[model samples]
Target: MSLSLCVITKNEEKNLSRCIESAKNIVDEIIIVDTGSTDRTVEIAESYGARIFYYPWNDNFSDAKNFAFCQAKGSWILTMDADEALSSVDKYKILPLLDNEDIDIYLFHTLSYMGSSPGVDTASNLNIRLMRNHKGYQYKGAIHEQICNVNQQLIDKRKVKIEDIIVYHYGYLDKAVAEKNKAGRNMKILERLLREDPEDNFHLFNMGNEYLRLREFEKALEYYRRAYRKFMPGLAHSPKLLLKLVMTLEALQMYEEELEVLERGLSCYPKFVDLEYLRACLFHKQKKYTLAIKGFKRCLTMEASPLHLRNINEVEGYRSYYALGEIHSELGDHEEAYDYYLQAIKAKPNFYMPLYRIAENLLKRGRNMDETKAALEKFFGKNLNAGAYGKLGDIFFSIGRYDSAYEYFLSAYEQMEPNPNIYYNLGMCQLYLKHYQEAYQWFEKIEGGRCCEDAVYRMALCEILSNHIENAERFIQLTPDHAYNKRSLVYKAFKNLAVGNPCGMLSDDKEESNAYVPIIFTLLNDLLKISAPEIFEKSLQLLNLIENDEVLLKLAKLYYCHGYYRLAYQEFVRSIQLFNKIDREGLRLMENIMDLSTGFTI
Candidate 1:
């Protein structure tokens, strides 16, 4: 039994050498099929002692691949793409398998690396990459092409064995460029095929995939839904079709529709981890944290490798832990949430999500500025992207460090295009620092985007703060659905006072004057009602102006309620600083009282 390595190429000069080098020692002969190369790809193939054959660019990969297979002289044909290479272990396994005369077609696993994320190098799948060179074997389709109709051929010949070897695919090396090229070529072929066979479900599915690759998701959904509708009941249902439909629905943010499709698929195939994971994502997006946690937990219970689990720490099933952390955080169980987040970080050291959440919780507590800043700095070090910088700005702003917050917010905004939230934050920070003109400019940039309502309100506030009363009134009149409408009215009263309208100032009743805290508390209370009530109540009381000593007493209760045993234990450390400030203020007041009394005695 002899083995020959076969590959199809088209201007694969950058990748051909690596592909051939990996297979050089394992195979007996090398056959290369070039479908028009203007580069040194063919020359490089010849350098590696490969028999080069030329074929016209027929707009079909399977045709070119089959042609290469037909030309191979060896009994066993091992096929690979120009961007794929056999691992050393796989190389060793292939050498033994080739020598074994019992095998007809050897199925090897291909691990495709779509992007560079730690602990997630590849997604694995099995393919008949190595096969016996008989006249009966051939390939099919144009895009996402496969060697099909082989089961009967194998059974007739009595030769088929699945190998445990792996091939690493670097085809997605530069995914954006590759997707563009692939989508263009595939769309042309699929369009022609659809014209010839208008009602073919398989072609429809492939066409849908081409559109998806092009990011025309709505078009993809149309084709996928057609395929699903045309699906035959007794015939082996298409897994790819169902998966693609689910994915299209997910991309559209049609969570309810996605759930319906998943439920239908699950009714047929009960234990599908992919569907479970997708459902979990949808629930999370809807802020249905408990259901999301349940779905992710169920997915973990299924038989899957660590690599197959998305955003999960495989060792201890930490996706659920992290989700629980988020839910707890939302609910106001800061201590339990923080512990889960810590566990998630411990399970997956490089994961930035858990760390960011923990930082957010600390900022909410208001006692750990130095520690929270340090944690954020470490997070930014690891994930130095726009989102991280934006988060840092949010943290600083929360603690009233407006200058530092503005610097970070500006860095995030200018480092990238002006995102609405970044501009919104930048505008608010500027308002606080009394840079009214600059604040208005930032708000102006957000006027046309999705953040328009918030932007308009902020702009109105900036005008009032700048004592531009008439302009402020005009801007406020321009938008009717401001979220902070009551706050805006109070600000308008203040602006009226600045412009000498004593009657306008007098109209500022308790409803308008004291609206900010209640509005915030209402929103927080609603969030708590959905998730964690105790923590929400704690956050409310902390920011409430009930009493000087009452707020301090509630902070300890908040920590205790959330199971932040460690943080609760250290509450006195925080109180000591507050106590010192209070004592100094008391002394100043006492001195003033004594001076007043001495004046009366004189």
Candidate 2:
């Protein structure tokens, strides 16, 4: 039983060598069908001793692949792509699987990496990649091609799953997708295919997949729903469709609908632990702690679903353990939360979330920098790297340890090249430590990176705090107009105060006031810590513009709680006079103020 590796290529010079080298020992012949390459793809194939066949560029992927298959001359065929490689451990298993006579075709688990980096997150699916040649097996579909027979029927029942033989596909990595314009190309092909057959379930599902990849969630949901209406259980993509539908609904904030679809999916494939993990996450989002805990614990007890059914890795181990830790943390069970976080670290030593949590929890419990660092070292052993240190710095910054966080962040930057996150964190640490000029310098390094807008906002604050009013106004103008940032009551108030345009605060309406009244007080208190007394007075004036008794009272309560008696006295008096009411807390505050002033209670 000889295996012929057949691949169709177009400008795949970067990846073809790896693909061929991985399979060189196992395959008898390499067949390369070029679809009009303008690069060294054919040259690379020639160097590998591959028998090259030239095929003209066609819009249909199935046509190109079928042409490649027709040129193969071996008894068994293995389909491969230039961006994929046979797993080193699993490559040898393929030849042994080809010897099985009863199975005409074999399915291999394809691990497709997501994001710009590999091994961080992946999605797995089974594909019919190896099959007996001369059995009339052919490729179908225009874009996301499928395998069919001479009569155009799927070869489903004759296929056997070989778990030991795996394929690692790198074409879906974010950088690769962007460089090759795969989403745009796939969208164009899928659209043309859908136009030809509007009711084709496979086309609709693939169209949904393209939209989902592009993050056009609403459009994705529409196509997914349409495809799901005609979904067949026997189709290989059925599970993927269900999972994507649930994810899209969740993205659209249609939680109720998401749960409904999740239940239906679970009913169909109860062993899909990833879906159960998602259900637990949804429960946690909705604050249904009991159900969330139960679901997560169930994930811990259950094994992984079959490779064909697995959408994500570690659903039953580190991911679930980390999630349980978060749930316990939210429930205020610190000890239990700490225990779960430890277990999560044990399960996946390099998982950053639980490590950050453990560090933050230790600091919150009054552990000093030395103790916190010792604990983290114990948990991570010798596996900690620059990325881990950066995360640890973020946790320290979160708990108000600016000096320690700054040290760790600087160390991380020294160990690794300075990225936008470290720049932002280092700038924030300096900002908090009141080294305004140093903070500005760090923020300046974030030129066009992911944290540019946030850095610009901090740059404005740095200028304002340093009394460079003109520079502050310029930076404020440069701040990105994100709705969540621009429309923030605190942000608006700060920008106005920085520009000396106190009337800019007047544009905030009752709706903004009503929505922000609960938390705005604490935000204002933080603002007061960084601003002058004049700015604090201006904030009071803005509060008066809202005409909210609750807002002023809450502000006064925050001041009193934090022992700012003078500020509390002013707020209490303002609230009492403006709203014409006084609660017991206000009366006590007034009495305390009077006692402080004259040694007598009012």
Candidate 3:
């Protein structure tokens, strides 16, 4: 019984060699069905002794595939794509399967890879890739086509068996180029189909998929939602359809809607790991840490191979460890968090995310500053990207190394287009170094937004510090309610002292009397080492009494202002370490204070 391998292609020059090479010794004849090729694809196929045939480019993929299958002359036919190849073990297994006359249709597992990762070990589904030529099998569908008649024929006339052989798919190699071609090809067919049958849900679904391939998510979602609305009620709740809906919701950033879709999908297909993993992500995004942890753990227990979900064993192990690390970090279990992060690195040493996260945890603990610094430096040395430089600057800023922080921040700012936050940070660094004129210039570059208010207020203070009294007073008058409002008032008082009207300044704003006094004392004492230590100790005591995080944080900054670096670092670390245990408002307040004081010094 001679075996024939048939493949359909159009400009598959790059991948055709691998496919043909894999089948060279296994088949008696090879047939290449070319829809059209303007390249050396046909020449390459001919070099492998493949009999070439040409067919007009039809809108239906199944029609093309079926046409190729019909022209094969061997007793046994194997259908494969130009981007697919048979592994040695699969080839060995296939030869024996082809010899078995009892088996009419044989299923082979397909593995698809994305990115630079290794092919996933798990096969999600089996396809009838090998069949008897005389079985009268044919393919169906126009876009995401499938072979249907063979299954019926096998059941009616002969026995069927599933082979352990696997087909490796490299279609996602150079995904951008392949996706561009696929989108163009599919859109042409789908547009024609939709023009003829506008209301067909399947046509709408195919069109949506084409749009999704183009990353035109909003338009894709419109068609998907339309398809779902038209078909969902009558259709038995399918995990596939539900998964698609959940993904659409995720892309739209409708977290609540995504959760609803996931819950519904989970109820219908409880064992589906894809749905579970997505649910976990939704929970993580919502900051529902406990639920997210539960879902991730459940996904780990599923029967599906990690590879089926586009994860290798290494990636799966690392993901589990990373998730545990994040959960523990949030729970204030720093020791456990650190261990899990190490485990994640062990699982996948080249992974940058775990290393960065682990360093962040170490910085919070304050016990591994040198180690964290080394890790960050190593990361930056290996990846000289803008993000790495920014993170390094952040580490320096956090530890009060203003000069080093400024250098790294400036490096990051210069290497990339300046973001408002980066400019604000540079401005803050200038202010800390007492470069009043330079600091004012940097702050003026900031536009008003959630992150720009503090910088704008600080710019006003720099005007006062540089003795621009009129500009200082104008800025102070224009200032609205902000975290730096109290600081602005103190700067105004300092401006008065710099001139000769301290008495007049002291008499105004009596309603802000309680807030301004300690701040003024802290600033004055910061200028005097002897009094600064005493004021620092008093502020620490006040911090203990304050129930509000904002108040505590303000007191902590006062301590820092008086050159109490150790105490300031301790307070900021405590706030960050307890981030998960606090209420939302409290967390936001602490985050803001940490952002202001830490600037990224390790």
Candidate 4:
């Protein structure tokens, strides 16, 4: 008289027995309606003494489930699936709910396990699994079927509570999900539902979920947007649909649109921390650090509440610390960043990214080099993904530690899945270190990929700088042989200066503008070292045609670096005349550099 567990089965032979076994003590009666099982599913159910009835194979899940519901003699009905089981903790919490006559429905939280090297528990979803049988409650829809209680007014939080009754779901594991082909099957049914009532946002939202599962983000966005527009105007719109739609927008990198959606939904669903967390990420990506900080901080203030019907993938505890740490680190707040990164490590000891970043932040601060080395040692052993290692390399590279950067990048290349970008970075570090021949070898290792053009261009620079003029020209010819862009042009000019010729004619104004000071300041400094009188003469002549303040300022720095204090002083004097045209920041930078370069000629 207490609880009747209702289940619908197909060829669930492998799963039915375990599911029934787990439910034996939880429910008084087991009512299973089989839709055609060729396996030992029925035999296993019989061993559990489940009252089984046959319904000819109908693709309609709700039909079969409703048939089982009708046969349940208990006062309350509990709908369950063959792939799910009640958690031990939840089993105890649920028993007390059955005796409460005032409660008409109960929402059970379902936790799915994602199949990977080590299975991960996904987010929680509240399902109407338990309700009074006298309320005329039955199932609806074919796929992702739901309970439609006739006494819907009693579904408020006061009468219906979401208990901590966890249902562990294995339907999303790699083998199970693929074997079931959930997305493919659901899409077919959802399309039919859409065709019948084209404007029905319910079907549209479901279609979006199927495509989202399959990673067809553009299609998902199309349907999610259509559904959002249809349902958003009314007070009865589903919070889950809006949240899922926002996720689709994020997958598409439509951050601006996602921000808009989040703002619209947050007012309606303020308690949803998942939305707040995503809003924080979106803000961080867009570099709105202040707003992002606020959003992340808000997540810490929320109590544990129900997330939407999608995968419960949001980090439950202090996971936002990792993101907050990244934002602080970018804003140059090392103290705050270091603290958050440590907190993140505490929250998830196995998480590799924060460990890697902690090393980077410590190294940047230069105060805790020993700790930085230790963190890197731990990270190197725990992670094989190239991104974390590559990022560490980038941090070193930015701080003028060429040898260290090259070593990290090479380590990344050695263990990573043969990505050409890592190869490109190795070549780039050697180029910065002025090991031209060594740089060429790294670039030569990659034969093809999206980074090929960039690698070839750098390789050509190496060849030209190493005095292999013919090889340089050959490498350049092998490339996309269009007009020289900024990088290629600067390197080509250096080649001309090296070969006792003038920096050749540029392709266009765009190419000329592209040769920024940072790209070739080192090349220019090297060219000034050439003892040949003609080379220095041509270099001076090259500067005559380019009279920008940046060039003049960089020339001053070059002169200072090589002890031409008088030449540097003269250049700085000339640069100051054009300082009015620059921004305030640029003006201050020029003055600071001029002061540092000022000295008597040696």
Largest lDDT belongs to which candidate?
Answer: 2
lDDT for every model? 0.68, 0.81, 0.68, 0.73
lDDT of 1 by residue, 384-487 (tens): 67776787787677656788789878878777975777888888787767688998998998856678876776676567556677888887667764334654
Give per-residue lDDT, candidate 3, residue 464: 58
Q: Write one digit per residue (lDDT tens) for candidate 3, span 66-85.
A: 88888899989999989888
Model 2 clash pairs?
none
lDDT per residue for candidate 4 within 1-602, as digits (tens), equals 48999988878887787777777797999998888888888898898888999998666778888888889899888888998888866676776788897787888778877764224446557777888887777778876676666656334556676676778777877778788898887888888877888978777888988888888999999888888776663433377787788888887777778889888777877776777888988888766789998988887777654534334454434568888899998788998998988887777766656765766677778846546655665645665466656876876766556677787788788777877788888887887787888889989988898888878877876776677988886776675633455555655665676687766444335445445445566556544443334545554544544434466766766776665666766766677776533333334444445555545331
For residues 1-602, write the lDDT of model 2, one tens digit per residue: 89899998999999999999999999999999998889999999999999999988778889988888888899999999999999999888888787777888887888899998887588888887898888899888887787779954555574655554679999999989988998888888888888888999988988899899999999999999999998786777898898999899888778898999889889889998989999999998777899999999999999888887888888899988989999888777888999999898889876667877887777777888799888876654577778767777877776667888898899899998758888988998888787999999999999777788768777877787787877876776665554454324455566566457755443347676676564456446545544456655665655655645566677777777666777778878877788776776577567767656664322
Quote the RMSD, in angstroms, for model 1.
16.7
Q: Better model by lDDT, 3 or 4?
A: 4
**TM-score of each model, paired residue for residue:** 0.58, 0.74, 0.58, 0.59
Clashes of each: 2, 0, 12, 1
TM-score of 4: 0.59
What's the ranking of the predictions by lDDT, best on top?
Answer: 2, 4, 3, 1
| Candidate 1 ranges with C-alpha deviation above 4 Å | 88-91, 99-102, 115-125, 148-164, 173-180, 232-237, 305-325, 339-352, 361-602
Report how far residue 561 has shifted in candidate 3, in Å. Answer: 26
Off by over 4 Å in 4: 115-121, 149-159, 232-237, 305-316, 331-335, 348-353, 359-602
